[model samples]
Target: MGDRWHVEVDRSVCIGSAQCTHLAPAAFRLDAAMQSHAREPEGEADEKVLEAAEGCPVEAITITLVGSGEAVFPPEE
Candidate 1:
């Protein structure tokens, strides 16, 4: 099976900074409620999308690989 990524955002923690949107415009976007949301990319997954999740100050974004169920996150500092 082809590789796929599942992205999710913790709306409770999203601060509307729009940083995710700025970083990965194709993967992250703002909803009608001004909440941040992570969507599956149309084609191949971009490393920058993961970077955006890492850059989120609130750590609200998370990315997981489908099937394998592996997840990635920014290092805790």
Candidate 2:
């Protein structure tokens, strides 16, 4: 996809699982506290990033279109 996306990791909901990091090391990272964070808040849409969000056990990872602000993961209901 050529579109851009915005990624976020809800630290409060993250459990230091590192699933995001494991799935998309280029898109996600874990601090010393093990809390997950988006490597780039906004970047080109990537399949690995989506995979990381989908694989998150707590669903802490959220992704949306950068310009449209449309939900990309956990899709709009």
Candidate 3:
């Protein structure tokens, strides 16, 4: 079994960049407003998901551990 992750997109900071969708199609999608959204807020941790978060132009995507709430993408500063 793999670790679970919680994915989130900050719409307010998001710039409708399709980078995430392009990077992780199975994990992200764009709505009518062109805002990025997580296909699965909580799901098995995946390399593509991490890639998507890293590719987000505005750094709007955030990923964290499902159980411990530990930051995954941006990491703790």
Best by lDDT: 3
Model 2 superposed RMSD (Cα): 1.1
| TM-score for each of the candidates | 0.79, 0.95, 0.97
What 10-residue stretch in candidate 2 is worst by lDDT? 1-10
In candidate 2, how many Å is residue 34 off?
Answer: 0.8
List the candidates ranked by TM-score, beginning with the highest. Answer: 3, 2, 1
Query: Which 10 successive residues of model 1 have the least lDDT summed?
Result: 68-77
Flag regions of model 2 displaced more than 4 Å: none
CA lDDT of each prediction against the hidden true structure: 0.77, 0.92, 0.95
Global CA lDDT of candidate 3, please?
0.95
Separately for all candidates shown, the number of backbone clashes (residues 3 or more apart, or on different chains) is: 0, 0, 0
Error of 1 at 14 (Å): 0.8
Is 1 or 3 the stronger prediction by lDDT?
A: 3
58 Cα displacement, candidate 3 (Å): 0.6
How close to the true structure is residue 49 of candidate 2, measured as C-alpha lDDT? 95
lDDT for model 1, on a 0 to 1 scale? 0.77
In model 2, the Cα lDDT at residue 37 comes to: 94
lDDT (Cα, tens digit) per residue for candidate 2, span 1-77: 59999999898999999988888998888999989999889999899999999999999999999888899998999
